[model samples]
Every structure is written in C-alpha cells, then in structure tokens.
Target: MRVAVVQVGYGDAEPVPERVERVAALVRAQAGHDLVVLPELWAPGGFAYREWQDRAEPVDGPVGQAMSAAARDAGVVLHAGSIIERPGGGEVGPDGHGLWNTSLVYGPDGGLLAAYRKVHRFGFGAGEPKLLDAGEDVVVVDLPLRDGGSVRAGLSTCYDLRFPELYRRQVDAGATLFVVPAAWPAARVRHWTLLAHARAVEDQCVVVACNTAGTHAGTEMGGHSQVVSAAGEALAMAGADEQVLSVDVDLDAVAAWREQFPVLRDRRL
Candidate 1:
C-alpha cells in the first residue's frame, strides 16, 4: 500500500476553510497513493483551543463536506486529520458539554468511513482536558486495498502516542496500520520520532505519523512526519518543515514479522 504523510502548519493567522481547501488541492494533485494522511486539527489550529467551541462543526458539516469532495476527486482514501466536533443534544455528557477533538476518514467514493475522537487528551502545556472531553472508545476501520486485500487502520491523536497500551489494544483488535495525527511541539521532536517507531515495533504494525509544521499560538511544532515499518525501520520521513512524505508498505510484512518474533503471543495480560 502506498501512503502519504503530510506535514503542514496550522496557525490562528490563516483562515481555516481556505487552508483546508488549499491542502485538499495539494493532496488531490498527488493521487496515486492508496491513503493520504494530514496533520492533526488541520481544519482549525490545535493550539487555538479558545476558538474550538465556536469553530466546532458537526460530523457532516462543511469541513466534512469539503474533505469528502476532495477524497472523491483524488480517488484515494483520505484521513483528513483531526477536527473539533460537537455531538448532538443527548450525545453530550452529563455536564451538558457537547464537543470532541475528532478525526475523520473518507473513502475514495466520498463516503464516511470512520470517526475517532481523541481518547487521550494532551495536558502537557495548555491542558486539553480543560477544554475538550476524552473519547470513550477506540476506532478501527477497514479499507480495501488495490492488491485485493484489506488493511485495518487504527485512529489515534497526538498525545495518544505517549501511551503504548492504546496501540497494543488496536493491534489486538487486528489493526495492521496505525495512523497518528499530531501537533507535536518542536521542543520534543525526539520524543515524537522515537515513540512513533516504538509503537510500530512493539505492535508489529505500520505506523504513520503526520504532524504540523508552523507555529501555532507561539508554540513551534516539529514537522518531521514519518512512516515506520513493522520491523521499526523508518521507511520515509519528512524534515522539520512543510512536506509530503510518501512510501509504499507491504501489509504482509506485519504478519511475517509477527510470526518471526511471536512476542505478542507471550503477553500475560
């Protein structure tokens, strides 16, 4: 499978819709890939937490519409990155709060494939828990590949990378590909790189991490978007700037590695 990881900026300085449109056009231009992944909170800047409630949209709202259109035009599966989502009336929690930090997936036919809310909120700096609620479940979806086999994709957000258990659970659920959309800071670029590879090696799956580039609300982001193989080899990686890194990964490698190592079978839990 051919996968593209996009590393771009998301700052309060630019108009959200216009930026989304521009990136969509860029992704459409590179349409030969089977899956195109974008950075976290590509629609609205992740650091723009103050505007999340006001800028939040429904699942089928304008942003979703735009992504659907782009996915259909590109003729490839698109993981459009994270968005601020407002759940319906009764879907809100007991506190009556109704929003989530969510990621969406669309098929080549412009149909909605999956919606994953970030289960582990990033509380390092600004403390995401103060603004966004945690998700209740994990999302694992299947996408048909051109090779006549299907790949199981797992959804996760920025801070979720710090927690290996999440990826392990997804692997147990049969996910062969792990997708992480992040707004990782420049101060901790090493952590971003190391953790992504660790997750892939530990879980024996292909890991794709797409992160933003520019500064958002005075916080500089490390833009080294990367794709790691099941054997913990870096297949392709971007620099600390805006870029699109694409690489081909054979899904069968995951199975081959798992059979050779068999570490997963020794888990006592």
Candidate 2:
C-alpha cells in the first residue's frame, strides 16, 4: 500500500485551532496514498504538559471532525495522530477529570475505524499517569491494500515503542503492519530509530514510524519519520522538519520473509 508519513512541525507560538486546520489540510493533500499517518499530539502539543487539559477534547471534537472530513475528501485511511482525550464518564481522577492519550483512525469512507488509547504513559508517577487512565487492550485494524483486500495493522503510540511484547502480541493476532505515531524528543532519536527497526525485525512486519518535528514546550522533537520493511530495510525516511513521506508498503513481503526466516515460530518464552 502507498503510505504517507507526515512529520509535523510546530511550536508554542502555534495555536491549537490553527494547528488542527493545518494538519487537516495535510491529510487532505495525501489523496493518492492508500494510508496517511500523522505525528502525536500536534494540536495539544505533546510536551506542553500544562496545556493538555485546556486543549483536551472528546473523540468527536474539532480535530477529529476535521480529520474525518479530510479522510473522506482524500478517500484514504488516516491515522490522525493522537489527542489529549477527555473521556466521557462519571469516573473521576484525583484532579476531578479523566483523560487518555488517544489515537484515532478513519477509514476510506470517513468512518471511525479504530481508537487506541495509549497503553504506556511516558511519565512515571506524574504527567499522564497522574491524570490519564492507562489503556488495557492492544489495538489492530484492517486497512486497504494497493491491489485489493486489506492488511491487518497494529497501532501503538510513542512510549509504547520500548515494549516488544506489545508488537509481539499484535503479530500473534495476525498483524502484518505496525503504525507508530510519536512525539519523540531529539535527545533519544537514535533509540527511536533503533526500536522501530527492532520491532520490524522481531515481529516480521512492516513498521511505519512517524515522529514530530520542530519544537513544542521548549523541547525539540526528533523528526525522522521512517518506513521499515519486514526485511529491516528503510524503504523511505524523512529529515527533521515538517514534511510528508510517501512509500509503498509490500504486504506480500511479510509472508515471504516470515516463511524464509521462520523466526517467530522459534519463540521459547
């Protein structure tokens, strides 16, 4: 399938509404691609901890509505990065609210395909852990292919990259492609690249990793959006900036590599 990885760049100067508008336009621009992916929390600013609550919105909020329309307009499956989700319910946290770092997906017809609440929060005791509820289930969805049929894809957010078992579970569930939307910082970009390839090699699936660019809350984002094949090859990569990368993902290669290597079957633990 043809994929577009949008490495968005922004700073504290950019307002949330304007950022949402810009991102929606970017998604709409990828009409020819089968799937379009964005980086995490571009609207609310991933590292801008203080602004999360004020900018937080429900699943059908402004950004979500705009993206759904863009997906329909473009006729492509869209992974609209992530949002600071203010989950609707009576369940309240210590701060008298509940939230989640939620990833949203829209199908070609502009319908909600999947919503993955980030399983792992970045901050240990503070930040996300203090405010947001952790997601329990692993998420995978079927996306259309270039020729016909669909490909099973696994979804995970930024910090979850450190955990191999998450990808392993998705592989066990028959996922052949993995989509990771991150707001990774510049300091650990090497780890970001390393872990992406590691997950692709270990799970024998195509890994699509899209990261943020520019700066947010004084922290510089690592902008190296990349697509790694099942054979651990970098099909395409983007530099540290706000740009979109288009690459064709070969689903058949997953089966071929797995059959030739058969590494997953040898799992002992």
Candidate 3:
C-alpha cells in the first residue's frame, strides 16, 4: 500500500478553518496514495490546549465535514489526525462536562469509519490530566484498498507513543499498520524517533508517524516524520520541515515475519 505522511507546520497565527483547508488541498495534490495521514490536532493547533473550549467543534462540524470531502476528493483513506470536539451535552460522563481530543478516520467513500479519542493524555509540562478527559477504548479499523486487499490500521495520537502496551493490543487485534499523529516537541526529538522505531520492531508492524513542524505557543516541534517497517527499517523520513513522506508498505511482509518468528504466540497475558 502507498501511504502519505504529512508533516504539517503548526502556528497559532492562522485561522483553524484556513489551516484545515490548506492541509486538505495538500492531501488532494498527492494523488494515488492509498492512505493519507495528518499530524495531531492539525486543525486547531495542539499548543492551544487552553483555548480548546473556544475552538472545539462537534463531530459533524466544519472540520469533520472538510475532511470527509477531502478524503473523497483525494481517493484515499484519511486518518484525519485529531481535533478538540465537544460531545453533546448529557452525552458526557457523570460530571456533565463534554469535550474530547478525538481522531476521525474517513474511508475513500467519504464515510466515517472510526473515531478514537486520545487514550493517554500528555501530563508533563502543562499537565493534560488537569485539562482533558482520558479515553477508555482502543480503535483499530480495516481499510479496503482498490486492489482487493486491506490494511488493518491502528489509531493513536501524540503521547500515546510512550505506551507500548497499546500498540501490543493493536497488534493482537490484527493491526499490521500503526498510525501515530503527533505534535512532539524539539526538546525530545531523539525520543520521538527512537520510540517510533521501537514500537515498530516490538510489534512487528509498520509504523507511520506524522509529526507537526514549526512552533506553536513558543514550543518548537521536532518535525522528523517517519515510516518504519516491521524490521525497524526507516522506509522514509523527513527533517524538521513541512513535507510529505510517502512510502510503500507490503502487508504480506508483516504476515511473513510474524509467521516465521511467532513471538506473539508466546504472550502470557
């Protein structure tokens, strides 16, 4: 399968709608890709954590609408990164509060295939635990290709990379491709690259990590978007700049590796 990873540049200066439109145009320009992945919180900047309430939209809002259109126009399955969404009032938990950091997956038919909220919230600097609600479920969806094959894709965002158990669960659920959309910072560029490869090797799956470039609210991002194979090989990588990194992934190879090694069969839990 041909996958396009978009390394987006984030800045608080641009309007959210304009940014979404620009990225959608970029995705549309890259024709013939089976899947298009965007960075986390590509619509409203990730650093705008405090302003989430103001910028948050419903799942059927403009951002999701634009993504549906873009996916259909591009003829690719889109992992539309993530956005701050406000769940309907009374749809939330006991507290009655309603908002989530959600990722929406759209098929080539422009239909919603999966919706995943960020399971692990980043709580180091600004402390996300105090701001956003944590998600409870893991999302993995099968994306059908035109050639009569399908890729089992797993959904994750940003800080979720630090947790390997999630990826293991995805692999156990028959995921061959892991997609991580992040806004990782420049201060931890090394960790960003290392962890992605580690997950790919450990899970024996393809890892396509798309991180944002540029700065957002004084925090500069490490824009080394990369695609790693089941053997921990870097198929394609981008520097600290905005660019699209496309790589061909062989789903057959994943099965061959797992069948030869059979490491997953030894799991105790």
Q: Number of the top candidate by TM-score?
A: 2
**In terms of lDDT, which candidate is strongest?**
2
Candidate 1 structure quality by residue, lDDT tens digits, 121-238: 8875355777777898988999866566779999999999999999888987999999999999999999999999999988888999999998887889998999999999999999
What is residue 201's positional error in candidate 2, in angstroms? 0.5
For model 1 the local lDDT of residue 53 reads: 79
By lDDT, the candidates rank as 2, 3, 1
Q: How many backbone clashes does candidate 2 have?
A: 0
Candidate 1 vs. true structure, TM-score: 0.96
lDDT of 3: 0.87
- Candidate 2 residue-wise lDDT, 210-262, digit = tens: 99999878899999999999989999988998888999887888999999999
The total number of steric clashes, by the backbone 3 Å criterion, in model 1 comes to: 0
The TM-score obtained by model 3 is 0.95
Cα lDDT tens digits, model 3, 1-269, are 99999999868788877898899898887669998999988787777777788888888788999999999998899988898878765467322346678999888889999999898888663455666677889899999786878889899998999999999899879899999999899999999999999999889999999999989878899999999989889999999989999888887989899898877788888
Which runs in model 3 stand beyond 4 Å of their true positions?
94-97
